[model samples]
Structures are given as structure tokens and as C-alpha cells.
Target: MLNSINTNPGALLALQNLNATNTELSTTQGRINTGKKIANAKDNGAIWSMAKMQSASSQSLNAVKDSLQRGQSTIDVALAAGDTVTDLLMKMKEKALAASDTSLNTASLKALKSDFESLRDQIQKAADNATFNGISLANGKTAKLVFLANADGGSFTVNAQTLGLAGLGLSLTATFSTASDAKTMIAKITDALQTATNKLSSLGTSSVGLDTHLTFVGKLQDSLDAGVGNLVDADLAKESAKLQSLQTKQQLGVQALSIANQSPQTILSLFKG
Candidate 1:
């Protein structure tokens, strides 16, 4: 059915083509402006799901990193206290040796006993005060730290390891009842020093091992963060190029739309002729 004056198929077809071009141009412009191929939930459901997963993983990794850092700090505090205790023990041993001398008078031996008592008090104080984040590491507390993989949901346990102070066999109590008893007491203090020294050496080894574990976990966290960034981070160069192209296409689409609207005027001129 042929119908209508001032109606031209050429003009109609051109207008339709122009409209389609305009829609395409607008879509590209939106992508350019947002710098995202899929800016909304409806754009790419699969990619959105993957991005969410990456975000969740990144959060978990960060939490694990914090846990490991606190664990390291706690271990450092314990190690430092251990070192202080060993030094005090060494000093006490020296005082014990001095007391062993027979030339020393009763007064001198009594003073040496007092010095030994003071050193023992200092060791106990160091142990009692060695804490991190309100958790004691050297006070014979049951604290342990643990690290886990992402597959395990990044699970971690704190306050699990406790140093056994009593097991180290260090006696700090004054035992000399007389000047003659000073020799035996000094020998006992020496034995305790040796035992404490061995315990401190073991603790040093454990501290080194914990530090190594922390280093490994830190590296793993870095790698996980990089992976998360790769999943969602924008490519600025590509976005910039796309913006330029979309702008040009938009301009061309506007011109094409203008030309299509003018095509109907040709039919009006034919009717006047």
C-alpha cells in the first residue's frame, strides 16, 4: 500500500540508520566516561561475580597480614625479655663466684647475697612485664599464634604458645643461712644460671623460626593483593584512547542525524515544483 504525500522511504531509512548510530555512540560514550566495560550489575554478571570474589579474597588476606604482624610483635617482646633474663642470670653468676672466695668477710658475703637477691627480682620483673597488645608472652601464659590458607578461610589462632618458666629450673630465692652456707648457695645459683642460659638459647632459635614464617606469610599476602588489583584496577591508557574514539563517533552520529532530518525537505521542494 502506497500512502501519503511528503513521505519518503529514503528519508525514513536514513533516519532509522542515524538513530541506530546515535544509540551505539551513546553506549560507547558511557563506557568511556565510566572507564568500565561493565559499569553496572546487569552489564556482565560473570565479571561482576569474579570481581566480588577478588574483593572478598583481598579483605581476607589483609586480615591475615594483620594477625601475622601482631604475632611477630609478640614474639619480639618475648625474645627481648628472654635476652634480658639471660643477662641478669650471668650477672648473678658473677656475684656467686665473688661470694665463693674464702677471703671475703661475713659482711662481704652478706652484701653479695643481697646483690644476688636484687638480680633475681629484676629477672622476675622482666618476665612479668614482657607483653604485647595486653597479652603476656613470657609470664608463662598460654598464647599461640597460627596462620592458615585462603582455602581454609584464612583462619588464625592467637595466644597458643606459652613459655614454661618453671621448667627452665631457675631458682631466685635466697638460701644462705650462714657465711659457710654461702659456698653451697653460690653453687646452686650457678647451676640455675646454666639451665636458664640453655632455655634462652632455645627461645632464640624459636624466635628466628617464627620470624621466617612471618616473612613467608607477608610475601604471600603481597602476591594476593596484586592478584586482586589485576582483577579490578582500571587501565588508564586504554580508557583514554576509548574516550577519544567515542567522542569522535558521537560527533559523526550527530551530523548523520542532522542530514537525515534534512532529507524530508527534498520532498517538499518536489511538491512545490
Candidate 2:
């Protein structure tokens, strides 16, 4: 309660409190604007670093997801082509059965032979065109696809199937010249159909496996994003409350400083004579 002309302790104390309140106000306002508690390394070095690392991990997983998608697409194209080839083989089997009846006339036999050859050529064409992203599973063009972006040992492997007619033991020069030839042709076509079916099944399995891996990676990326948010994101509700309280404290600080500044003037009244 002592007042001196040379020193003003009240003013000094009020100024100190005002500066502290201002600092808090500035920090609260920053959070409100940026919506982040740790906007930079200066805010919280340890937490910022951790969030940064997780963000990098999320990016890597995103790349893995992309690769998985591409691999799935490639497998899909191959499966479709294989299914068409299976259908073609079945038709060829019917033609072989018809041709086996040596009682048929020469004209009818030639027609059957032409129809069968056309189907065989179509199977080859289907295999050749079954490509996605410049990748073909049949024709032994590609064997496997791997997707793992991180340096750590984690990846999804998708296997390809060889459903090409040539791969299935279907020879281009194979012809049904006699009833005996027709019997042999039927067996070979059956075997090729079964082989293509097995390859299709394997491709389907690989597709499902890749899908499962992609789903898991999606969830993992989401978790990483949430973790980063927990480390750096601000609670706007909490910041709003602090902002109002600091504003009130600032007003009080100003009033206190005004009162202290007037104390020096009170010394003038004491000198009245």
C-alpha cells in the first residue's frame, strides 16, 4: 500500500500479469485459427515428430493400395478371357462329337471343321487381348505381382495363371482327319478345358487374397490418420472457452494498470497546502 515517486510496484505487477494474459490469448487464438495444437515443431517437438512419421507411413500405405488395385484389375481381365476360352473349348467338344460320326457327308464335315477352327482361333485371340496395365497373366507374360511400399518386410503377392491355348496343350495344327482323330481331339479339348478351369480358380483365389490385403491396408491408413490427428489437432470447444476467459482477464488487467497509474497522481493531492 506504500506509494513512492521513484518506484511503482503496483504498475510493475499489473504489467507482468497483463503480459502473461496476452501470451495466453495469443496462443489460444492461434489454435482457433489453425485448428491444431502442435502446428509446428516449435509447438511440441516430440509430438510433431511422431505425427510426421505416421503421416509418412500413411502415404506409403496409400501407394500399396494403388498397386493392389492395379493387380486386381489385371487378374480380372485374365479371368474374363479364361472363361471365354472355356466356353470355346466346350463348343469345340460338340463339333468333335459331330465329326466323329463318319456317316456324315463331306460337305457337312467340312462345315463342322470350319466352325471348330474358328472357335479355336478365337481362344487364342482372347488370350492375346487379355491384358491390363500392359500386364497379361496368360501366355506366361507375368507370373506374380508384389505391392509393398515400406522398407519393412510386408507385401501382398498376387499369382497369375497360364490359360493360353498353347499353354493348355492346344496345338494350332491339330485337325480331325478321321473318326479316330476326332476321338483324340475330344480328349485333348477336355483336358485343356479342365486345365483352364483350374487356372481360373487359382486366379480367383489370388484376386480374393489381394482384395483382403487392400481392405486391411485401408483400415491401417485410417488408424494412422486418426493417430496423427490425436497428436496435433486442437479441441475447438476448449479453445473457445479459454479465449473468452482470457479476454475477460485482459480487461481486468487493463483496469488494474489504470488504477496503479493513477496512484502517482494521488501523491499530488497529498502535497496540497
Please provide, for model 2 over 1-273, each residue's C-alpha lDDT reduced to its tens digit, 9 standing for 90 to 100. Answer: 777988999999999999999999999999999999999999999999999999998877877888888888888899999989999999999999888898988888888888888988888888989999788887677777676633254777777677777778887876686766887899999999899998999889988888887788898899999999999999999999999999999999999999988889989998899
Candidate 2 steric clashes: 0
In model 2, where do residues sit more than 4 Å from their true spots?
149-153
Q: How far is candidate 1 from the true structure (C-alpha RMSD, Å)?
A: 3.6
Q: Compute each candidate's TM-score over C-alphas.
A: 0.80, 0.95
What is the lDDT of every predicted structure here?
0.66, 0.87
Compared to the true structure, candidate 2 yields what TM-score?
0.95
Candidate 2 residue 210 Cα shift, in angstroms, is 0.5
